[model samples]
Target: MPGERKAETMEEVDLLVCGAGAGGMTAALVAALEGLNVVLAEKTAQVGGTTSTSGGTTWVPGTHLSEQAGVPDKVEDARAFLESVVANRGGARLREAFLASGRAAIEELDRKTDVKFVAAAAHPDYLDGPGAAYGGRALGPVMFDGKLLGREDFDRVRPPRREFMGLGGMMVGRNELGALLSPFASLANLRSTLGIVGGYVLDRVSYKRGTRLLMGNALVARLLYSLRKAKVPVLFESGVRELMIEDGRVVGAVLEGPTGTRRIRARKGVVLATGGICWNRKIRERLFPAGTRDYALGPQTNTGDGADVAMAVGARFDDGGDSPALWMPCSSYTRPDGSLAVWPHIILDRAKPGLFAVDAKGKRFVNEANSYHDFAMGQIATGAIPAHLVCDAAFMRRYGMGMILPGAGNLAAMLKAGYVIEAKTLAELAGRLGCDAKVLAETVEAYNRSASTGVDEAFGRGSSVVNRFNGDAEAGGSNPCLGPVGAGPYYAMAVRPADLASSAGLAGDEFGRVLNEEGEPIAGLYACGNDLASIFRGTYPGPGTTIGPAMVFGWRVAKHAAGKLTDQPETVSGVMTDERTKNATL
Candidate 1:
């Protein structure tokens, strides 16, 4: 058997990281920086999995960024918040580990790599719990110029989702959205708009897409560029087909790549950071709740290959999250090219004044200003299979609905495509939406009464600080998240729940080691990213919850593999440091 297997080309590396998403890239980069010969393998041609198309917020509390920004936060308060909100699912240890090592991990990355982050001035935690903050916990990636990576190297990084782009592939960030929408609103906004558009125009001359990356795209680009500087080889279009185990230890992996089959011998360890089981139908059917539709925002390539291989080698999964998956309510419409465009309804219009979500029966179900996860939970709890986001003409024009822009640039096209439903009256709208006319009218009347008084009796819509932050500040109402739906010309868009990422994944220890059925670490095997069970056990604590832990644990895995594990928060400089970091006073 050994002789027969020798036919395949064999390569050696200290650390072999499978997947090139945020987590895997972090591991590869960290391992290289720690003096390990590391190689990253991606299943697709490009790097950055779901991360490239996401908002790219990383939520790690008590970091230098937070401190520099003067955000008031205490570790104990964060613990209290977690304890109050998260289910007691035996994940407290991992959660504690995350909180403890987060700062060090971030500082290390900042000191040794090109991955830079800026503290969000006012990005609040999802839930306003005891330890919740108004801002500074969530960090966003700094804007990156793709030109720095050069055109060829930049092409290897995944682009943002087409629906989120403008002018056929120009990426935009959440903060710049206001300026992009109303370029002439102010002189500053006009300059910003001109700069962005000008950059895009210039980029189109040489690149396939705009080289001005922002949000998740920028984060990915930064990581990729850093990996290049470290001279780490990221094998694109390569997949690990089998994990080579010897005497109960993972030794290496059998990879199938563009060049053909080969055996890569890993001297140190193998980190599995594949993007979880998002597109795995069999596992999804078993893990997901009954009646859930098959919709996920992650790439189709994430078919649970890593989990399958790990499970085959005696790894057990921890599927006990409060919810099996993290969710976002999404509305879909067919593009002109016959492709489906699924737009995630995150913070654009749902929380603004004069909007409410109703079930098929035309009765309000949840607070429109609640976090996306909570909003999806409300849909599931109330059996709102396809919830209708109702708003009047003025509201639609001021704040977009689904993929429709604020100006309703292509409203007729959207209506024709059945993406939006418009009617001249409440009864007509209700009839078109298959709701009871009387019930719909009564619901609107009750809502208008509460809107007039600036108080939502059924649900405290804008009572929370985070809620008001997303609402239009210029709205003429006491509650920015509550306003009366103007008369006639009502609009409604149907949305359904979709998994933003998987929470249930392979059981892993605090050190990022994959655990066997006996609850012991599998020697030389570690897992991070969505492949590892969420530390919060399926609860969304704040923005960038998934990505935050994915990166933190990724760094931990690299340090542990390189024999440089340390709990100290002291800042360290330089790359390829072989010395074990000493513990220092926090």
Candidate 2:
């Protein structure tokens, strides 16, 4: 393939990054800062991919932010948490690299760029089982102004509409909501809310446009602004159709853009951060046979394009069984196009109290208030009839139900529509859902007894603030954790295990290099975010677990590609052409 005629194509860059999501953005920013000419391409018209739709929390323990917040986190504690959950799962080298590089990445972002970080005060780790801190381990992005980007016509990426509880009837974070509820805390929350409302109203009146509030959206805005400042050429609405390979190495890519087909070469590397296959129906049917109808909560553009392209180029993948990206239980509403806008928080408030999610034989399988990952895994492990959330009259009257507008009539309508079921008693409720009546009754009785004692002896239901947050506040007893509902009019609704996104893809080493079929690292190829198999394997250690690793790995990959490692060889030589060849040494 030597001296092959150069094909007519667009200009090349030092690095060509696909997918402008969190990982891709991080990689692009890092690479560009290292003096590499970078071009970041996104399939969507806008940048900030799924990160725009997330909570913007990154779980990194032993960081300076945590220390500044007065929550001391030790490396030993973090190691303990990892050992308790994800150690020895897979790719140990990668896990070590992640842990070692996470803090440095955060520091680099804070010092070199405007990516400010603040600890999510008091956010509990997912397990909280043992050696877990009650908050201060996770960091969230502070608010940034979108107007600074100077792209007034562009659709700025923001957090999911649900995560924004600000002015204009917006949503607030759980911690903020709790502060709003407490009398003393309410005063602070009130002041914050008023400030937000006042700023929004003034901006709207003066500018003749609604003011955009930042929470999670601030993370994306900051990244986008940084990318802009760095002058990284972002090709929007452009997707990689295939890896253009020659002489047994990747040279460029065939991109299907809005205008026409185009090929772009990469001088240094191609980073795959196109996200995972969460929305593809065919893949969903293959992976989740039972819950095929559940719409993914992530971006619709995530269709495993990167995985497919890598496979086409002779890359093997890990069998990420039972590990599809999952979201919380949601209710769907039909859109004008006759499709569905699936909401993610349907089961949180309504199903937390009297409702006990049971398997086929009517047995409680998991703590109701565990993280969504645990809850979804429980659904998968049950493998019986579809999970059911069992509830009572008190739960119905106080919490309302589902995604429908909160009202008694809506609840009745849902019941009539078969989305929810109701009966005069627990046995009757089980009978309606075709579950064993006696078993359900016993489960409810046991739960009620635990509620009376104020401690969930069975599953430690009230052990964490997350658990109590969703629990029935009015349930009285020595244990505010549980309350018995002996009253009539019980209910049950079928719940399907859902995912926020899938976490499996191309396998990478400690430096995020894509491995070939023979388990050898492919030079100049890197991956991060959900596009790479999770370093934790199947276990989630805490909140922001996914994003934290993504950012860390992204930085690692960028550094490695930029030849920052002193111990590593200065140069890795391989043929760079547009033709097929035998395996050659690097």
Candidate 3:
């Protein structure tokens, strides 16, 4: 074959990316700070995929961190709060390219690198609808010192989430879960729970894991230490088994990993950023919502492998939204080593002040401080699909259920491992959830007459601002989310709905490229976190609504793959071995 040279099984690069979360490491750290020639791959073996078990927040509205916290925001009031809660599902030019690249990709990744962030000046927006704000567009990540990712690259950063970590391996954050869950409330929450259990007993005698990296595992260990100080390689377990189309464009990717099958290429594109399609069960039974069930504990290597390798190369599938996933409500059990956990009710005991969720005729349904993506669609529009939540035993000995901890764990081995259930009455917790004990004591005497008049009047649980940002601001004159499941030995748990994020993806354009079904643009394809689509289609806006359009369309797919290079290098210098990137020295 004439001196057999077709670029020897190819492994080049001008940008390749594909799922290393936080929008594939902020589109391979802004296409390797413009110098390009990036790589990134990652299908697990750790590179912080589900954005390292989240809460790293990113929302981003009008910025300058809300004009230095006096709260600013306006891109026409974030386009009138995404046209009053994203009804157009990712259009209007991808929601005005996520309001002009969400504060210019967090002020150019904080002027280029240790990837800092701050703006949660009271995090709100999860819906006050039209131009909502309360807290200038979320923002979070300021705590990454995993010894600056060295100690063998900080043990490959991906901590936080052995069921949201704590004591048995540390890493707590969110203001140290309020002084380690209200340590006897004061004395400054007992010296912040003895300085967070003496810094996890001195971070377990010099680390093996907790080197103190906060949420979304300190934004994926500060974007994997800014892609290893802008050297940018990332590989991990690899993946993307297809997408090399030639004359049609997308020039590279056939990965697989551990050295089997290679073919990388990528002259100036290929971004994708998987982390979506919520554990795809044939795209969650063809776009969720009908007894939905991809069982979402997030990151089971988000099958939908970059939307089935970009819709098997002819991309297309935005399957619209409004709930193609992104709800919560999880609960599973098993842990005394047999592993199984799950948990995820998100927001500490559903905005405190006791709790509720019922049904099976025992009544009560949602608004237990809403937003767990609308309380799992208000338990499937109040049929309360497999519900229960309840709670008591003095709010389970000061907040803790679902992963059952407080007094630091074990409520009689989580009620003999049934995951939770205690009941000293409510007619023995409605005779152990078979419901009817006079309709669970008339739904706990009409929810203790709407918690002694803090007035839920059926479903108002601490009326909004994200339920006073997850309630209990010193629960004083009651309704800090209406507490009053008063002291019974009660408990409960047993719930359903899951999928933390998927909301139908693929379909792109205002620069992150990808798009088909005749709408055009697939050339050298691209996509950003959760592989595009969701421009609020499934609407869960704020508190980092899906990492602020996955860091603003992964910095608009690295400035549209650096403007399809006509011989780039007029200055993309973050130094990926300069010399004007002589074909990235392949």
Report the error of model 3 at residue 508, Å. Answer: 11
Clash counts for all predictions: 0, 17, 1
**Residue lDDT tens for model 3, 127-180:** 777778887778788887787676777777767668777756778775667667
Task: Quote the lDDT for 165 in model 2.
Answer: 41
lDDT minimum window of 10 residues, candidate 1: 569-578
Pick out the ten consecutive residues of candidate 3 with the lowest summed lDDT.
571-580
Residues 458-558, candidate 2, lDDT per residue (tens digit)?
78776776666455555554543456666878766666655665666787776778888888877667788888877777677787887888887778777
Candidate 3 local Cα displacement, residue 483, angstroms? 23
Arranged by TM-score, best first: 1, 2, 3
Q: Which stretches of candidate 1 lie over 4 Å from their true place?
A: 1-9, 566-586
Q: What lDDT score goes with residue 362 in model 2?
A: 86
Worst 10 residues of 2 by lDDT: 577-586
